[model samples]
Target: MAKQFERIEPAHREMMGRQAIFFVGSSAGDSRVNISPRSTTHFHVLGDLSVAYLDLTGSGSETAAHAKAGGRATVMFCTFDSAPQILRLYGRPRIDFRGSEAYAAFLAEHYPNGEPVGARQVVTIDLDLVQTSCGFAVPLFEHVGERPVLDRWAEAKGEEGLVAYRREKNTVSIDGLPTGLDEA
Candidate 1:
């Protein structure tokens, strides 16, 4: 059975906390829909109807571009171990670029240890709907651990390299939409 809620419930938050990964979906209407798998290490539930996650440097900036152009996003979490449930959050997203006060506050509050090497921005979502559904058809899998490859790669690139790389590759989406990286 499926259920819908206006806000995230305690059970939903608990489920989200236990998950090792989540998926983000976004689109710019004229562009391709972007779906990216993200680690939950930086995911934060700010309120019953709001959530935010640290956006890291990647090969592309599809999410940021889509969020900028459309302001809509969906984050999905599913249990791969304990229970069979899928939770989806539909919301309007705002991108707070690095160097901004809002991004600094988010980093201080949720990641006081210091920002990760590839940290780029904070993507905050003000959710409009929360949906839960049976995920019995989804197969279970064990989480070995988060891969260190990204961290290692970022460290190898160094800060300057990362900036150049972002300038060269992350400034545009696959469909040629501006990703707002230049402003970040």
Candidate 2:
């Protein structure tokens, strides 16, 4: 059986905290649906109703374009090391383009070092509902580490190089929607 919550309860939040990786799902109407597996130290829960993640520049800006087009995003965290449960948060995210008010506020709170490299905007999700499902069949795995190459590459590139990479690779969704980013 599946359990649902109007907001994130204490136990549910703890379950999410223990997960090392989460999946982000987003799409535009009548366009390709994207489900991406991401592992980064970029997510934080502000309250029972809202969560935010710093958007990093990478190939295919599906989440940004989709949310910009008024699409909802669902973030799922499944326990694959110890417990057997899957927690999903259904919400509509508001994108915070860099230099926007929301982005400034969020960065003020969480990113004192400035946005993460290969940076773009931020995605703040206002939770509508949270659901937890049984993960009896989900395989368990050991927690290893996040990818080191990209951060190292971005670091080596320095600030200007990172921006250049974003313009080259993260400017648009695969569907060609504007990702609210420019090279310079």
Candidate 3:
């Protein structure tokens, strides 16, 4: 069975919080559609209709590019254990780059410990629709642990090297769309 709602209910928030990972989907009309799996380390449920996650340094900034190009995004979370259900949030995304005030404030509020290393931006979504469906067909996987590779790599790169890397690899999407990283 599938159900739809205009806002995230408490049960929905619980499911989102319990999920180990989520998938982000976006597209800029003619460009390639982007789907990326993200960890929940910095995922935040800001309110009934808002959510956000920290965007770390990655090979492609397609999500940011798509957001810049006036695209909507869908974020999906599924239970890998316990009851089987999948939740999808459809919304418009805003990217707060590393040095922006929004970014700093978000960090201060949601990430009291401190921003994770290699954090490139914060992607916030103002959700318009929330949907849930039975995820009976989705396979269950055991939780192992978070990989330290990214943190190690980012730590090694440091701030200067990270800026250089973002400049090199994140300025453009695979389809040649400007990712706005250069401006950040």
Candidate 4:
């Protein structure tokens, strides 16, 4: 069975803090939906009804594109090494570009180590519903460390390289929707 809530409770926030990876799903109108797995230590509980994460430069900017186009997004956190539970947050999301004030504010408030090397934007979600389900079928995986490949790639790219790469690869979503990355 599943349980639903109007806002995140304290226990739910604690569980979310323990999650190592989360999935972000989004769709804009009739465009193709995107579900991307993100592994980061840069998420924060803004409030009982709000959460945000730093968005790193990636091969696709579908989430950003969808959010910019007024799409709804769902963030899911599942237990892979502990209790069998899956929590889903349904909300309206927004993308704050790298140079924006919102991006800088998030960096200053949540990321103690400062902005991540490959950070491109901030994805903030204003939650309308939070659901939890028994994830009895989810497989258990031993905890490991974060992958260094993305950080290494971002360092190699530098600022200019990252911007160029975004232009070449992240400008448009798979369905040809502008991601707003080009403007950023």
Provide backbone clash counts, one per model: 0, 0, 0, 0
Can you list the residue pairs that collide in candidate 4?
A: none
| Angstrom error at residue 130, model 4 | 0.3
TM-score of 3: 0.97
Best by lDDT: 3
Candidate 1 off by > 4 Å: none
lDDT of 4: 0.90
Between prediction 1 and prediction 4, which has the larger lDDT?
1
Model 3 off-target regions past 4 Å? none
lDDT of 3 by residue, 25-115 (tens): 9998899889999999878999999999999998889889988888889999999988999999999998999999999999999889988
TM-score of 2: 0.92
TM-score preference between candidates 2 and 4, better one: 4
Write the residue-wise lDDT of candidate 1 on 141-170 in tens digits: 999999999999999999999989889998
- TM-scores, in order shown? 0.97, 0.92, 0.97, 0.96
Instruction: State the weakest 10-residue window (summed lDDT) of model 3.
Output: 175-184
Q: After superposition, how far is residue 116 of candidate 3 from its true place, in Å?
A: 1.1
Candidate 3, residue 129: Cα displacement in angstroms equals 0.4
Q: Which of 3 and 4 is the better model by lDDT?
A: 3
Q: How do the residues 1-184 of candidate 4 rate in per-residue lDDT, one tens digit apiece? A: 9999999999899899888899999999998989988874777789999989888899999988898899999999999999899999999999889888888888878876777898989999999999999999999998788889999999999989998898898888999998887777
